[model samples]
Target: MKQLYDQRISCPHCGHHIFVSLDASEGDQDYYEDCAACCNPIHLNMHIDYAINKLELRVDADDEQVF
Candidate 1:
């Protein structure tokens, strides 16, 4: 099945809303983005399965991993 999966994630640095898309065909399993409000880097850990059309998202850097 084909779908356009997306999620709204908040930036941990500035609490900004970010829109992320799940591109299974392009192998976009995991990625990161920047916060528009604070100009800080955001780390995104995503897992997408095309077969079941399931998407899991984890945003921001770890407590020990500084930006």
Candidate 2:
């Protein structure tokens, strides 16, 4: 797996497309980034699955409630 990766994702707040840099060297990560278009917080959860050799990224709005 690559140590560094770039992913294009849409902002949950404004639906703006943006590029995010992911660092796989750190294993799994949970972080927040401000959307460029709306300036709203975007929650990012990154998980590296060693068994499948895949990187999973989940993006959502910071204010979203989980049911």
Which number leads on TM-score? 2
Q: Estimate each model's TM-score.
A: 0.67, 0.92
Instruction: Give the lowest summed-lDDT range of ten residues in model 1.
Output: 22-31
lDDT of 2 by residue, 1-67 (tens): 9999999999998899999999999999999998888999999999999999999999988685679
Candidate 1: residue pairs that collide: none
Candidate 2 lDDT score relative to the true structure: 0.94
Clashes of 2: 0
Give Cα distance to truth, residue 21, candidate 1, Å: 2.8
lDDT of 1 by residue, 1-67 (tens): 4556677888898788878766656555566687777877888876666678766677865546558
**C-alpha-based local distance difference test score of model 1:** 0.71
Residue 38's lDDT in candidate 2: 90
Instruction: Please state the error at residue 45 of candidate 2 in Å.
Output: 0.1
List residue ranges in candidate 2 displaced over 4 A.
Answer: none
